[model samples]
Target chain A: EAGVTQSPTHLIKTRGQQATLRCSPISGHTSVYWYQQALGLGLQFLLWYDEGEERNRGNFPPRFSGRQFPNYSSELNVNALELEDSALYLCASSRRGNLNYGYTFGSGTRLTVV
Target chain B: QKEVEQDPGPLSVPEGAIVSLNCTYSNSAFQYFMWYRQYSRKGPELLMYTYSSGNKEDGRFTAQVDKSSKYISLFIRDSQPSDSATYLCAMNGVGYGQNFVFGPGTRLSVLP
Candidate 1:
């Protein structure tokens, strides 16, 4: 089966600008989760969306927000970006109740904020 | 302390050598344990997943979880240079704590 797919493999944005990252889950998956992997810092959970609703989020600021589309795709929006915001943003999708082996992830979108 | 902690080892080992990686977690409620291998600039690929405590083996890789000690381990046998990458340990609880928590990752380098 085709794995998760993400758009704009690389992005370069200015400080204070906005960054938008997109993700398409597997064909039958319905839950999408966003994670930021900055240098030195590991996978920091950003947001979790299930069935078109935001289920949970990490300790990140409100500027880091996202939504899941009807088709189970997701978009992450980072507003007022800062240098530290530069990182690889990954999106994973899982079957609603099958959280075990369903966390199929995409390669990720590398965001570079100057 | 972080929920999950691992040694960020840039460990170098010759090919054919056995490799061992470990992680400790602060939360005892986590029942799902996983090991992920990630290459540079790439996303992580899940290597093993075990529920609760026990050992699960897949080819050259093995995953062991010890809930009493809140520790887990991954062992790679007859390692090759292709085995070189960052290994991350992740966990999740049932119901309210289903979110996956990850470690800082341990970088392994298998020299040819």
Candidate 2:
């Protein structure tokens, strides 16, 4: 089976601009998750979407929002981006809402906010 | 303290050596443990996942979880240079859609 896939492997934006990253979950997966990996930092949870509904989110600001499409693909929007927003944004998917089911992550999009 | 704490080790070891990586979590409710291996500039790949306190062996990799101490470990036997990568430990509670808390990755370098 094809694994999780992400689009626009890299993105370049400036402060005050908006950055959008996209991800397509593995086929038959219903849960999509977003994470941020800043330099020298661990993966930070951004958002979670299951069955086209927002399930939960991390401590990130409101400007960081996203939605899951009907096909189970997801998009992450970082508005009013700052230099610190320059990081690898990762997307993952699970077959179900349970975390015990494990997750499959995409290669991620490298966002360079200049 | 962070929910999950891990040593950010640029651990360098010789090939064929036994390598150990670990993480400690503050949340005792986390019943599921996972380890992910990430290459430079790449996303994390699931290495091993365990549901409880026990040892699960797969090939040369073994994962052990100690619920009493809130400690989890990954052991790589007969390690190879290709094993060089960042290893991240993640855990989740029993609630529906519990967030997976990840630790600062431990960087490992297996030199041939």
Candidate 3:
């Protein structure tokens, strides 16, 4: 079984520019989650999408947003990126309605805001 | 205070030594606990999961959760150099769409 997959292994964007990251969940998975892992800071949840609907989000600002497609793939958009926005953005997938089971994570997209 | 607190240890140990990692959470509602091992430049892989409290052992790994103290622990017996990585502890409540709170992670290096 293929695990979660993320595109653009590494991305470099200038300040004030926009960046987009993509993720593809595993087969038969319906829930996709986005997280940011900054240096020294642990994994911080960004967004949660299930069945193409945004279910929950973290304390991040509105500039950090994303959506899930019908096929359970997801896209995370960071608008007006700042130097603080540089981090490894990870995508995870799990079976819908199963909170007890842990998620499977992708290698992550390393975003560097210059 | 943060919801979960873990010592960010760059702990070095001998290959055959026992390794112990722990995390303490402030939220009492968090019922599900998990430990993940992440390699350099790679995403975290779930190592163990437990609900509420008690101990679960898998091979050389053992996970323990104490609901009263809101503490969780992971133990590795006879560790190997392959276990060198960051171990992260995550937890969440019972809600379906609930998000997990993760620790800063402890970096472990086992020398062969």
Candidate 4:
């Protein structure tokens, strides 16, 4: 089976600009999650979408938002990006809404804010 | 205190050595534990998962959870160079749609 897939393996943006990272979950998966992995900061959860609804979010600001489309694909949008926003954006999907089901992650998009 | 605390060690070990990685959590409500391994420039892959307080083994990997002490561990037996990566520990409660709190991963290098 195909694992999760992310687009534009790498991205570069200037300060104050916006960045969008996309993800396609595996077949039959319905929930998508977004995370930020900054250098030395580990993985920080960003957003969670299930069945096209915003289910939960992390401690991120409103500028860090995203949505899951009807097809279970997701897009993570970081608005007015700052230097601190530079990090690898990861997307994962699980078979169910519960955390115990485990997540399948995609090769993340490396976002570099200049 | 942070929900999860992990030593960010870039530990170097010889191939075939036994490796032990650990993390301590502050939240007693967390009942599910997970371990993820991330390669360079790639997303983390789930390595192991366990519920409550106990030990689960899969081939060369073992995961242990101690709720009383709020500690979790991942053991790699006969470690190989292919195992060189960062290991992250995560935990969450029984609620649906809950976020899996993650720790700052520990980097491991199994030198062949």
Q: Which candidate number would show the highest DockQ if scored against the true structure?
A: 3
Residues A1-113, candidate 1, lDDT per residue (tens digit)? 89999988999999999999999998988899999999999999989999999999999999999999898899999999999999999999888878678388899999999
lDDT of 3 at B42: 100
lDDT of each: 0.92, 0.92, 0.94, 0.92
lDDT tens digits by residue: candidate 2, A13-71: 98999988999999999999999999887899999999999999999999999999999
Candidate 4 residue pairs in backbone clash = none
lDDT tens digits by residue: candidate 1, B19-105 = 999999988889999999999878898999999999999999999999999999999999999999999999999554447999999
- Candidate 1 CAPRI assessment class: medium
Tell me the deviation in Å of residue B74 in model 2: 0.4
| Candidate 4 clash figure, as a count | 0
All-Cα superposition RMSD per candidate: 1.0, 1.1, 1.0, 1.2
**Interface RMSD values, listed in order for every candidate:** 1.3, 1.4, 0.9, 1.2
lDDT digits (tens) for residues B1-112 of candidate 4: 8889998999999999999999999878888899999999889999999999999999999999999999999999999999999999988885534678899999999998
Using Cα atoms, each model's DockQ against the true complex is: 0.71, 0.75, 0.88, 0.79
> What is the TM-score of each predicted model, taking all chains together?
0.98, 0.97, 0.98, 0.97
The fnat scores of all predictions, in order, read 0.57, 0.75, 0.93, 0.80
Tens-digit lDDT track for model 2 on B1-112?
8999998898999999999999998888899999999999788999999998999999999999999999999999999999999999999886635579899999999999
lDDT of 4 by residue, A1-114 (tens): 999999989999999999889999999999898989999888899998899989899889999998899999999999999999989999999876555668889999999999
